[model samples]
Structure formats: C-alpha cells, structure tokens
Target: MTAAEHLLAAKSFAELRGSYSGALFIIASGPSTKAFPLQRYADYPMLALNGSICCLAEAGIAPLFYLCDDSSFVRNRLPLLLQALAHAQHLALSPRVVGSLLAQEPQALDGRSAYRFERVNRLPEGGEAMSDRRFARQARKDPDFECDFSWFRQKPNRIGFSRNLDKGYFSSRTIPYAGIQLAYHLGFSRVFLVGVDLDSSLGRFYEQGEQAVKSRLDGDYEDYILPCFRLMAERVINPGFQVYNLSANSRLPAEVVPKIDLDQLDALLAAS
Candidate 1:
C-alpha cells in the first residue's frame, strides 16, 4: 500500500523485453499526442506510457504495443486501461496500478489476446510515495527538490532492480525515469516519443475530468515528470541507441531527443 512498496514492484523490465523487438515509442498523453495520427503507427511496435492509453483510445488507436508504467494519476485510470488492454499484445504497468488492477478487477487481464502483464517498480518519489520519510528528508534539505513517493515496504510482483539502477543518486529511492529506463531495457535501438511533452504549455498531462486531484501533485512533481527525462538522457543514451521527440511542440532537453514534426513522422513512415 505504500508508494515505495508499489514502485519497487514496478522495477522489472526483462520479462517485458522477452518477445518484442524493433523500435518502441514511449507515448505520453500530452496535447501534441493528439496531433499525430497514432492509429497508423499501431503496427509499428509501440509502447503507450501511462495516461497515454486514454489518448490513444480517443485517437482511435489500437495497441499492437504495450503500455509502460508512469504515475498513480494514470494508475487510477485502470478501467480505461482494461479496455485498451484488449487491443494490445502486452501490458507493462507499475506495481501500484497492478495491485489496484488486480483488486478492482479480478479478471482484468485476459491471456487470450496475446497480452501478458509486466510489472514495473516505480521510482520512489515519482508516484504517491512522496509521503515517504526518506523522500521527505531529501526534499527538506534541497529546497528545489521535486518528485513524490510514499513509504517503503517489501512487496511481491516487482521488477527486480539492476545494479546500474541502484546508484545512490538522491536517496535510497529513485524517480520517474522509467520511460527511458524501461525503453532501453526493452532493447529499443531507436525510440520515438509521442505526447511526452511534459510542459504545461502543452496541456495538463493527467486529465481524468478530476482536475482537483491532479492539481495537488502537479505543482510539486514537475521535477519528476520532465526532469527525469533529462536525467534519463544522461543515463540511458548509448552508442547503439538514441531517442527522438516526435511531437508538434516539445521542450525536452536537447540531449533527450531530436524533435520531429508530425508531418515528417507521417511522410517517413509512408515512405518506409
């Protein structure tokens, strides 16, 4: 029930990478996400990250790809995800969401549709874990600190952490760099980012018609949503792989990705 407990359960990625191969895009639910024709890319080995499942459904997009874990804001959107899951081959979600999902819908996962559940251990301080003492201590001394998490507790069904991930950066806990971490762990040589526009100029990232609940964490966690991507670029970019931002409007760090116009994505895919 603790945020750390949920996040730790979400850390695994090996099982998710087992079958899929090819470029996997980490899709977010930013407004720009609606500008692109996502349905066309359904067959292009995609991965919908968190709240993206809703935007994809709105765009009439089907998930040949799976969904990656991100936040509890999206985690609460489980019913919509269940509907989206029927269209995807696999579903990799944060352990918090997974626990909630299992509790809410005993039979939410249907193995018949080529779908298997992959668990994600959330980066502490990124989810509802901000209430955690460890995270609180870090933020207390560092005024500019961002990211939120809950208390830590051992949990089952979490993705095991790798040595590279356990570096004592801020604290014993971690943050929301999962989009990049999970993407790389999935063996994506090239990444196409959609809707990952973390800036508010694009629009509220978590829109469930419940603006009040979203507003509470949005202000404090801005550091987690966008900065983590920059952090991810520093940590995950490698010789064999690179990331590109494919949004109509984006403000990701230059190191994160080379921004691409939607038209370019369409034309490039059409040509291919």
Candidate 2:
C-alpha cells in the first residue's frame, strides 16, 4: 500500500478517545529498558517509542501502538523504522515523520494501521511564537528547524498534555510527552513509563558507538522537559489518571512521577 492509501485507512484520534480502559506501558529507548521483563507484561498493551520497538520485536511481542515523533530518526533509521512498522499493530506518527516517509519511503507505511498527529505548542492559545523574519531565515537554512524560544517561559502552564489529540499533542523535544498524551487519549487511566531515564549522556540502550542518535534531552531539559513534566504532574496525575515511572534510575525526580519497582507494578496490576 502507498502512504496515501495507508493514511486513508488510518483511524483518527477521536475514534480512539476513551476506547480503552486498561493500564498501558510506554516503552522508551533508555538503557534501563534492557532490564525490563517483557514476558511478565505480554498480556497488557504497550506503546513503543522510536527504536524501543526493537526490544518488543526481539521478545516476539507486537506493540499495541508504535509512535515516532522524530523526523530525523525516520530518515536516518529507515531499516529500524521498517522493523517497527512490521512489529507494531498500529502507528502514531508526527506530521514531520509522515512527511519524511512520504518523501523517502512511502512503502514503509504499507500494510499497517497508521495515524498522523500534529506537533503543537504546549498551550492552545499561542502557537509557535516565532517572528516571520526569523522563521523565514531558519526555514531557508534548515528544513527541519522548528524551535523557537520566544514564549517558552511565558507561563507556568507552558507545557500541555492534550485531552483531545485531534487538535494535537504538545511537544517537549521528547517523545514521552507525546506518549503521555496518546495514553490519555486512548483512555488508559494507569500509565506506566518504561525506560524514560531522561539522561542524555548515558545514551540509549539500543544504540552503541556510531549507531547512536544524538539526544537533545539535556539541552531541552531546563526550558522544555522539566517544566513540561512538572505541569503534567500538577494537572494530570490524579486518582483518575495515574502515571508511574518504572525506571528506578531515571533522572526525573520521583516527586514529578512516582517511581515503582517491578513487584510494586505487579501489585498495582493485580489490584487493578
């Protein structure tokens, strides 16, 4: 199937809203994920982010949904992306990634349930607040340049977790933010984050030496990631919507997201 054909068959975010009522585990590419026992959680749904799909693929388990918000990863790691497509039952791709696949490898999205999502600002009121001249200059130099620091620190609620993904998902220069929004939209009240270590220097568990993709997490932390998650915790984490961090060594403080061991996770699942 062509990319267009796959997109035509893809389900909208609205269609998935409140469609599920179970716990969800969001798998990231952090090194801590290597220790995660996929066998124990095989019965539950999992969302694989970027190269983390390889972990599930290796374990012979298909991800309930595969999400890739980075266009560069799509372009530089076509083989891995194709592997993800093969292992994922459904895909949630950012507009930029879709454009990259449409340009370079439309056939990669073939024979899969795929959906496209927009990357919007943290708040609905103000979009990316870049000046026209600056936007034009950046656009002229780099097609992928989309960052602007104009209104990043304007408010405490700068980071948004979209309840309605049809509008878009807030981007924090990290995939987990989008994953969180996707989980919420899918009606997963209990969200478990697996392998979101958030330390750029440590690198990803799936990549080694030259195969590693450069991480922007460290640089984006102060301005984007920290504030984003902080607001997310304050506004989103509640009895109705609980988020737990499975990575014990994660750089994110337990205050923002409570850390849980495997036994605790099992207990929570059993109780739920």
Top lDDT prediction, candidate number: 2
Worst 10 residues of 1 by lDDT: 154-163
What is candidate 1's lDDT per residue for 1-272, written digit by digit as tens?
33334444443433455344456667766777766677767667666655566766676666555554434644556656676666555565545555566566655653423222222222445445433455444543442232333356421112122212221122112222344454555666667777756555435454635452333234534434444454445544666666778864565555456787767666545643
Residue 8 shift from truth in candidate 2, angstroms: 6.1
In model 1, the runs with Cα more than 4 Å from the true position are 1-21, 55-61, 68-76, 110-177, 201-222, 225-227, 263-272
Give per-residue lDDT, candidate 1, residue 244. Answer: 77
Q: What is candidate 2's lDDT per residue for 77-158, written digit by digit as tens?
A: 8877888878899889875677687788756766668877666432222345544344434433432222233324443333
| C-alpha lDDT of residue 110 in model 2 | 60
Report, for every candidate in turn, its global Cα lDDT versus the true structure: 0.51, 0.79
TM-score of 1: 0.61
Q: Per-residue lDDT for 110 in model 1? A: 34
Summed over model 1, clashes come to 13
